[model samples]
Target: KRMLAFVAHKPMKIPGQFRKIFYEDFAVHRDLLDKIFWNLVEDSTVRSLNDQLDQVKAPTLIIWGRHDQLIDVSCVDVLENGIANAESVIFENVGHVPMIENPKATAERHLEFLAKN
Candidate 1:
């Protein structure tokens, strides 16, 4: 609950029904989550993919939350500049998980991008 609040721009907006599922999922995946965290800390080489962004040839749609707490929105600039074929959309007043924050808008953007590409 605390971590969710930290990551979400408006945690209170999260549906009550989904909260239980979220908690259960987290509890089940706790070990996997710990492993992933440790791996990220230990593997310095996997820290950033910025250097390899130029190698991406496929059409890329970068969706980000303007108020993301985990990763600052400024990184979107880096992605746009780095990727040759990249389109980005920043969701205003959204946090780390924009899909959960605003699913309709997020899905619309995804569908639009998919339709074009």
Candidate 2:
């Protein structure tokens, strides 16, 4: 259920065919998932990176979903403001995985960013 929510703009947007795939993926990766979760939970590097964000000199594009359940859209500002060369594009009515939920728009944004950068 959480996987579906993360991939889709909404739970109902999840295709019926992909439900079984997600279930199987979870079953196969449950142990790995637990390890990753615990590792990140214990890692202080995640928070410490904030102090270094301004050091990033490369152009950065932050494309986020307004409806992202896992990470709120408001956090985009942190990236945009912290990075030296950063911009953001917010996709409304979308969720965490914009590449999957709205591939066309994601690709378009990427193309635009590439052309500009």
Candidate 3:
């Protein structure tokens, strides 16, 4: 049931039916992630980012998994509030990388968001 829902997720892509594997595959590089993401994990860094977020005028779409374990979901709310023209959609049962766990839905949401602006 869970797998079917994932497979049914929104976006329909032309070339990469196997694209879901990419996010899962990419996550394997834990060392690199820690090296890069740690800088943004700090409160000062995240808060500082809000200032820049305010300056961004592009239409933005934020897709977050409510159950994400790696990064706190609260950050999504922060980003949503900071960015002026941003929309957020949360997948309640998903985690940090919903793209991997639920590629279809992720793809659908991404395409839908992209089409609007």
Number of clashes recorded per candidate: 0, 0, 7
Tens digit of per-residue lDDT, candidate 1, span 95-117 = 99999888899999999999999
- By lDDT rank, best first, the candidates go 1, 2, 3
TM-score for candidate 2, please give it: 0.79
Superior by TM-score: candidate 2 or candidate 3? 2
C-alpha root-mean-square deviation, each candidate = 1.9, 2.5, 7.0
Tens digit of per-residue lDDT, candidate 3, span 1-117: 343444433323534546567656766986798877776677665577667788878988998887766567798988999888999999867876678767799999999988888
- Among all windows of 10 consecutive residues in model 3, the one with the lowest summed lDDT is 3-12
How many clashing residue pairs are found in candidate 1?
A: 0
Question: Could you tell me which residue pairs clash in candidate 3?
Answer: 9-104, 9-105, 10-104, 10-105, 10-108, 11-107, 11-108
Error of 2 at 54 (Å): 1.6
* Candidate 3 Cα misplacement greater than 4 A, ranges: 1-34, 38-47
TM-score on alpha carbons, each prediction? 0.87, 0.79, 0.64
* Cα lDDT, model 1, residue 71: 89
Which window of 10 residues has the lowest lDDT sum in candidate 2? Answer: 5-14
Sorted on TM-score, best first, the list reads 1, 2, 3
